[model samples]
Target: MKIRFLFILCISVFQFISAQTLSPNAQVSILTIGPGSSLNDAFGHNIFRVKDPLNNIDIAYDYGRFPFNEPGFYLNFARGKLNYSIGKSNYRDVRDFYKWQDRTIKEQILNISAEEKQAIFNYLKNNYKPENREYLYDFFYDNCATKIKDVLESTLKGKIAFHEPVAFEQKSFRTLIQDNLDYNSWGSVGIDIALGSVIDKTATPEEHMFLPEYIHSFFGIATHGHSKKQLIDNENTLYEQQNLKTHNSFLTSPLMVFFLIAIIILFVTYKDYKNQKRSKYLDVILFFVTGMIGVFLLLLWFATDHTATAQNYNLLWAFPLNIVLIWKLKAQKPWVIKYLKFLVIMMCLLIFHWVVGIQMFAYALIPLFVTMIIRYIFLIQYFQRSNSR
Candidate 1:
């Protein structure tokens, strides 16, 4: 209890000191952290830092902090209603956290006047209040990085003009996201299955600032209002990431595993075809898996508030009706044959969609798609023979 009391007392003193007026030596900077190995860290992070040695004030503001302990965490995340908050932390603690993760950290000192810096610092302090902290988090429009960009723009109030970075080009949201993900990894596959055609549209140059590295590049070249002066006073790397050897298991790679499954399925399918026999187990499992995936996509589209999931075209291949077809395969109903034909047509449609740049499916799906076509064709022939017999 004494330790807790001392901790609380220290925090109170720190807050009191931080709220004091800033001296001329006070500086506000942006900290950009590079990506890490995990899926969650594929995209980098952006943070606001305020330091005043005169007042012994040094703190970092993080806008990506979410209230995971709040009620309905899972439900709200799925419904796209999760709220993130601006969290204040010790600057050294924040730096150490990223350093421990081996992520490179860079800081950009702003060129604004001390008064402007004070105003920005005060605004951040006010925003960190419990009542004002939480904000609706949007992946494309209002993520952690965008919060920093938007906050600076709003606080500066026409005092800054963000220019397009020389290294930037207009790319689609899906392409930008996929650049940080391996084509055959589970994260890539899951994202491809969840998001829809809306992400395929090309993003504007300004829209690219949603990523942290882009924010760093753009802000470095930004100009002061009505003047050609640069917005950044100085830039320096705070911590450089050290090189580390990485080893990935080849057996677990998506391409290797999926191709093996495809080969086995095709071999069994070919044997069944030559013997004029059907593998009821294989058909049941295929229908069940595809149908379940289709059902999940349907739920994400209609039941959830996820905007990017609304117009998904993966249903063309998953085919939700396969759930019912699982049992219907035994009877070899006439309509079931037509349904298999429709499935084949839908696969063709998926390929057309991919070609036309409507939506980009996972590259690992190639082997699975080939297996699907072969098996569906074999099933059609078997059904036709049974109908004739």
Candidate 2:
């Protein structure tokens, strides 16, 4: 009878223990990781770290994870329809991964009542469920950093007041992104090409939290409650990135390659001019390439779900009509000369746009732009002389 009573007592104790909540000693911290050399890692990362030694719970939750096995993964990513999900990982494992990549990791311990902590913890738990995990990933609006911002604001019921960083200054979204990217890098060039004029608008102070570093900065200055109590109890550096030299080959850089191509185009154009002849082959190649690029830009703007590709001004230089008139380049038709003149005008407009900062163009494109202008002028003069003959 005593053994049966003891078993009942043990069962009750186990049930009671299972029902217990997190201890008051529990801490929730924001983990901000520094950027790496890769284009994908240039924007850095944000994560939630929940630590409870008494309950033996130490885990990091990341909203940046996406399933590689999802149907049409590449297709969805290309169309801006990719779904990112919340993933839980051991804190040590996440640290080790960043350490291996030589990226710095920092942490900010959040200050709040134990009840608020519990609420936030419970909310994360609910959000990590399979059904609730997935969300549409947008680079500018709803990325990993923005997710942290939204979650904190939502769970706190608008009590958290995010102040502008001490060094905050209003800047266009494109400029802010360019600060993190190398101007001469292929990544920067591709971004300048793919994204349109929309990102050139000035970002609001609150909107700067889209980047992980901005999130870390703004959250540090954040306050809560009517008394303006501080939201961060402490800040820490988990790892400092090592200063290791990375070798970059200059031969493959954009400036060098584009300059060479521009020189070659100029040399060919000069040769044609001296002979009083037009290079139909050269015109065909240039027109085809530029027209194809323009077509691609149009597809990205119209067919794709990507919001940043709309209102692209690169179309001014790479007009799609160039392809349709490929056959007409051989004839000295009046309309052909008129079309060439129109191209020359569009190039001038592109220059005007660049000078006024309507949209930032690639610096490496200067030589190419000059080359295109000279070629178009030569083509116009050639067509005029041919039609007069």
Candidate 2, 1-389: lDDT as tens digits: 99999999999997666334678899999999999989999999999998888878888998999878978998998888899999999999999999999999999999988887777788888999999999999899998999988888888888888787776799999998999987777888889987899999999998888999999999998999556999999999999999753635668878778899899899999999999997778889899989988998998899889888899998998888899878787544778888988999999999999889898788888899999999999988887888778
Q: Which residue pairs in candidate 2 have backbone atoms (N, alpha carbon, C) closer than 3 angstroms, thus clashing?
A: none
Candidate 1's TM-score: 0.93
Give the Cα lDDT of each candidate.
Answer: 0.89, 0.88
Quality of model 2 by C-alpha lDDT: 0.88
Error of 2 at 236 (Å): 0.4
Off by over 4 Å in 1: 1-18, 244-247, 330-332
* True-vs-predicted CA distance for residue 124, candidate 2, Å: 1.1
Q: Ten-residue segment with the worst summed lDDT in candidate 2?
A: 14-23
